[model samples]
Target: MHRVLLWIKQDLRLDDHPALQAALDADRLLPVYVFDPELLQPGPLGCRRLGVHRARLLLESLAALDGELRQRGSALLVLQGSAERLIPSLAERLDMDEVLTLDEVAPEERAQLDAVRQRLGDIRLLLAPGNFLLRDDELPCPVDQLPTAFGPFRQLVEQRLPVFQPRPAPARLPALPDNAGAYFASLPSLSQLGLGEPLSVANSAFPFSGGEPAAQARLRDYLWLSQGVRQHQQTRNGMIGSEYSSKLSPWLASGCLSPRRVLAELRRHEAQYGRNDSTQALWQELLWRDFFRWTLLRHGGALFRAGGLKATARAPRQLDRRFQRWCQGRTGVPLVDANMRELAITGFMSNRGRQVVASYLVGELQQDWRHGAAWFEEHLLDYDPASNWGNWAYLAGIASDPRQRRLFNVLRQARQYDPDAAYVSLWLPELHGVPQHLRHTPFLLPHLQLDALGYPRLESIPENWRPYLPSAA
Candidate 1:
């Protein structure tokens, strides 16, 4: 009888899980998740790979996954310590004939796979498709041959869109191996993981819980019940509410929901509602996600380096007080601070707000882009290394079409996106007393008046911001 160990990495759910499907033929199966200490330890960039918010979500997800498996006569085996050490040892102790897992895209994750494989010895280490919309063979061109710019890449991929058919979850997973009861350990709490419980932010745009069930509910609500996707193009930039965007990213990043499943549902929605600009916009976002995944595959470790894909490129590497202020949302720029505070408090930010804050960090604060990226890795509920790092590199002008440096005029963007400064006031109550017209440009107020609000003062204002500042200020 064949014994198989299904290694569950970020791909948490069994629905449409390629690796789980591949392991079904085994007479005995065990699904295991190893919580690596490296994720909680600070990296070279001075930030832990996992933070309190994502950690809470991750624990909830693991519990939900366990419950699902239990219904199918199986249970998730939760372990701790180094994956390279634990996975191999578990396989041997269980006498697993082979170990199967989904493929990974990021350099660090790929390195982990290599380490685990080296330790597996004679046992086979099988890899299935990763959490992406397109399979390697289904891409328009080879990873190396794909366009460096998103525009050209999107164009090429759109030429022949593949029909996505996501598989359903197995009704009954194979029974667990004998003597495996000890391995189905209990999940840890946030405090036990050396992190405090994150406060519940009432104004958080992403108020949803973690797990496959929540992910599926979100997908259904977005595409069917509420049909909010119909206006995604118009409201996606809004920072206040959940209806603005699909909000499917956290689930996607954690593999609680399959990308192919999302695409298939999107196609069904489009077919029922008749394709519109909103649907097209969401489709483009998926394409961008895939583009970043493919980019990471092509570039490997370079995406996380100081210079990114451009070896000769000059990029900031300084960690100054300004970077700290930016992270704390005390930069005295209303829009930037509001967005940053929202992220710090809620562990989520609007898509539009991310661009604004990232540009400010790289262009205005002039801090190391990796520091900002690392901070996001710690905070964002939807942190995907490929999209997160790839985007930071793009904004820093060192990856994905180096010619584009996304520098935003903070004052201008504030007026355009948060004209009433509601988003600003929501996160930065200090600015609530400031007049709506002068809210975004509080720095223009006299030092005495500004000090009264307890808001930090901008050390310097860009010349370009003069045009966007209100005349009354």
Candidate 2:
């Protein structure tokens, strides 16, 4: 009988799993997951995104996956080490003939795959798609030819393209070796991984448990019980509450969910409840997600550079004291400060807050955009490398935007979105007593009032505060 190994990376779920199906096609399957040390190392922000909460959820998900596999007479093997070393070593030890895994576009992940291929001599590598509905090569335009503006990209893809349907989950898995259970041990705990205890639900946007089962339940509730899928575009930018958005980013980031599954369910909702503008809006956002993935696939290592995917000569700017103040949430801008504080504590921020904080960093403070991007990588539970880097480059005027230096009018945005000061009050308690009109710009209040509120005074605005305009010929 042929022995096969399935190397699980970000594609963590059983449903719609092409790699897992390929493994089962063999006579026997050895499912393994390696915890790479490189990923656990602290990023430039001095914090690992795999914090206590994510670690705990990962352990729980692994346990569930093992149990499900056991029901089918198989068990998952968990190993703690670098994938480059561990995966090939296991393949040799088990005498496996082939290795199957979902394809990844990120540079770092691709490097890991390359290392594995080099170590294992002439081993068959089966690549499958689970990340996006459209393949990278299948995009209508090449990376260089693609539009630099989001609107044009959205228009072209949404109007002309079609999304692929998701594959069904396997009814049963292949049996494992007789000694598989004895070799497999318990998953590492949060504390065991040198992280803190599980995060309390009070602070998280997604308080639900992790794993594919939980993801499917959320999809059901969001579509059926709440019927919020129909109104997603209308309420998605909300900051005060959880129900406003789908809150599927965490699941999506961890690979517990697939975008195809989400699209399929969304179509079902549209069919049953009748299509509307809101449904189209949600589809647009999902397309944005796909667009970012395609961007990374096309550009590869260029996404991490200062001038992302663009042929421009730009020098890295010197870091200013004002930039540090923004990072610490002491910019004296209540809306921006509150959003930054929320991200620091909860590791989650609304999309509106993300854009605002990113704009404040790159546009207002004139700081190195990479610093803010690194911070998001360390803190955000839903952090996708492509989206995070792509967004920062866009804000920094280095990536996609044809007209560089997109500056957000913080005050105008505050008046439009947080007019009632609800979101501001939730994060900045000092501004709780401030009136709705002045909540966005508390520095405008009188000196004695500001002193009474315990808010700090703002210094001179930076030179970059002016609206960005294209250079004249």
Candidate 3:
């Protein structure tokens, strides 16, 4: 009987998984997931790059996957090592004929795949596309010819082409080889992996469990029961709660849920509940997600660079003391500080919070944009390298847009999104007494009044609050 190995990375779900299906097509399959030590090491953010919450969620998800596989007379082999070393060694030991995996587009990820390919020279490496809606080569424009703006790109794709429907889940998986479980130890715990305890559910916006089933249920509830999807466009900028957005990014990033699954379910919801402008707006956001994935695939390492693929000049900035304050959420900017503190405590932040804090870091403090991006990489449960880097580049005016340095007006933003100061109050109790209009500008309050109000008093504004001024690092 032919032996095939299914290497699980980000694509963890059993439903609509092309790699898993391909492995089952063989006579006997060995399913494996390697916890790479490299990834667990501290990134530039000085934190365990994958925080405790996500690590715990991954363990739970893998356990669920293992349980499901066992019921089918198969098992998920959990290993901890560099995949480049583990996969080839396991293939040789098991005498597997081929390896099946989902395609990866990120430069670092592609390098890992290439290393595996080189090591397992004779073993067939079947790469099934799971990460993107459109294949890299299938775009209407050449990689170089793709539009720099999102509007034109979306318009072109929506009008000229159709997004492929997601594949159905395979009816059943093939049984594993008799000795598949012998090669690995038990899955590691959060503490074992050097990560802290799982986050307290009471404090988290994304309190739901991880796994395909949980993800699907959340989607259903959000779209149908809660009807949050109906007002997604309007309320998505919410700061204090979970209902503001779909909260699917964590699942999507972890591969517990597929984007296509979300799209299909969204279509079902629209059909049953009746379509509206809100649903279309939600759809637009999903398309944005797809666009970023496509951008990384086409641009390669340039997405990670300072100037991006187009090679624009980046504004030079110094990492100053104010940058440290921003990082620690002590900037005395209530809205910015609250958002940063929230992110520090919980691994998630609202889209509005993300933009505000990012802008404050790059624009207000004049810190290096990359530093903020790296911190988000470590802290965000939903951190996808492509989206995180792509967004930072955009905010820093280093990528895509000709209007570089897109900084938000903090006061204006506060009045518009958090007009009642409810979100600010939740995270910054000191700011609870601040009026709705002044909550975003606590520094503007007189020292005696600010002290009476219990808000931290800023000594003075940084000398470099000018628009488009490059921060000194």
Which candidate number maximizes TM-score? 1
Candidate 3's residue-wise lDDT over 229-330, tens digit each?
998878888876778888999888889888877888888888899888789888888878778777777788887765654533453356877877887888
Return the TM-score for each candidate structure. Answer: 0.97, 0.89, 0.91
Give one digit per residue, the lDDT tens place, for model 1 in 1-473.
89999999899898999999999899999999999867899998899899888888899899999999999999999998999999999999989999999999999899999999999999999999999888889888778899989999988888988998888999998999998987665798888888989998889999999999999999999999999999998999899988899999999999999989988999999988889999999999988898899989999888898775673157666788999999999998989899988888888999999999988887777788989999999999999999999888888874223465447888888889988988898998988888888888899899999999999999888999988988765
TM-score rank order: 1, 3, 2
Off by over 4 Å in 2: 44-49, 136-138, 141-152, 155-160, 201-203, 311-316, 398-405, 433-437, 445-454, 461-473
Q: Rate the local accuracy (lDDT) of all candidates.
A: 0.89, 0.75, 0.77
Positional deviation of residue 369's Cα in model 2 after best superposition, in angstroms: 0.8
Write down the RMSD of candidate 1 (Cα, Å). 1.6
> With candidate 2 superimposed using the best TM-score fit, by how many Å does residue 54's alpha carbon deviate from the native?
3.7
| Quality of model 1 by C-alpha lDDT | 0.89
Query: How does residue 215 of candidate 2 score in lDDT?
Result: 78
Give me the candidate number with maximum lDDT.
1
For model 2 the local lDDT of residue 104 reads 86
Q: lDDT tens digits, residues 10-100, model 2?
A: 7678887878877767788888888755566787555575655566567767777777677777778999988888888877777778888
Scanning candidate 3 in windows of ten residues, the lowest lDDT window is 464-473
Residue 387 CA displacement from its true place in model 3, Å: 0.8
Question: How many clashes in candidate 3?
Answer: 8
Runs in model 1 deviating more than 4 A are: 398-406
